[model samples]
Target: MTQTVPQTTAGADDIQEIVERILSAAALPPIVQAGHPALRQRAAEFDGQLSRDQLDRLIGIMRQVMHEAPGVGLAAPQLGIPLQLAVLEDQFDVDPEAAALRNRSPLEFLAILNPRYAPLGTGRASFYEGCLSLNGLQAVVARPESVLLEYLTPDGAAEQREFVGWQARIVQHETDHLNGVLYIDRAQLRSLSSNAEYAAHWAEAGISKAREGLGFDAGPAGISLD
Candidate 1:
């Protein structure tokens, strides 16, 4: 389901109070849409602004919003916060078929700050990707099969790690938000489909079939789409 910020005119403090209430009680914040000014601009680095305890609280709030939105990942821009932060947790239990077909396994909750990534090798892959900011639609986006990511953990520790398969895709997708990029910007528009249409037409089809169906060429073995 889609959510929107309230339409009524209100002051900043009023909005802040509402957001606090939602966090303290039982409501999910409205996810900002694609054309929202915040989503288009590059996110600011999360310098040592908020205290450690404050960062911890923000993480908790973001995780809650991510789970409540029922999305695998969410970025700060999606909530109108222009900071380089994101949260992700790939829960595969509900759609085991899609998960297995997509080579996506369950992932523990992860929070990354000021993230950046580079392709690990020359290999590439394509897969249907969706964004909370661009709700209801999924598109085929070509991305590197493996990537080396550099980022600061929520606790401010620097980390450098390599990820392959679906994990790599997740990192690429989230980190792109730091630069104000969306999957759709790199996706095959002809392969676009609404979420329901995606389930109907390509959910069970292997990556090759979907690629062929959408007129895209598939890559070699390890970097295989599926």
Candidate 2:
């Protein structure tokens, strides 16, 4: 039986408002596009131990930016910070059963710090991928269907976890940002086509299986609050 979590009063619009405020308030530099050298250069250290107040502020800002942009993920560098941090929101309204099969949740967000990733076992999955930085492009990228991650939490506690399916893919993409890498770097030559072309390719190749396999039949999934 699928379990459903109670819906909260929070909505996307509410989150968007917070994001706009953060963009206006933050002294972030403009977003660096896909080919920018900075996107290739490794991000600098976050410098100094993060205070609770500062970590909260960064998290809040990331949440706002992500909401306004309506993206699956966002990174500190996108917000003009050269730090090893990022936020991911995997909360699009999608089929839950498909999500479960694909190892994904409908709407979940994560704040990752100084993350490191490794393949979980073997086997690889190819999926069409896009990025907030690239905006108008999509490509087929091959990645491990599952992975293990180690990272520090916002509170500076160590955490380790295993991820699979779309969730694992999303984590890999975002962790690349922390390391200053973009999906385009790993994009397949033929998959580097336009969005429409890539979508068609993905459909023909059963890439959508990952989405259809994810299960949202269970109630709302829980996110880490720590």
Best by TM-score: 1
lDDT of 1 by residue, 1-226 (tens): 1223222233345434434554565656688888876676666677765557656766788888888777888887777766678887887574666666566777788899999888888988777778878889988777888899999998889999887878889898888776667777677777778989888778652566677677766532212111
Q: lDDT of candidate 2? A: 0.65
Give all candidates' CA lDDT scores. Answer: 0.73, 0.65
Model 1 spans > 4 angstroms off: 1-26, 94-101, 218-226
Worst 10 residues of 1 by lDDT: 1-10
The C-alpha RMSD in Å for every predicted model, in order, reads: 7.3, 12.8
Please report how far candidate 1 places residue 80 from its true position, in Å. Answer: 0.5
Per-residue CA lDDT of model 2 for 112-134, tens digit only, reads: 88888998887777666788788
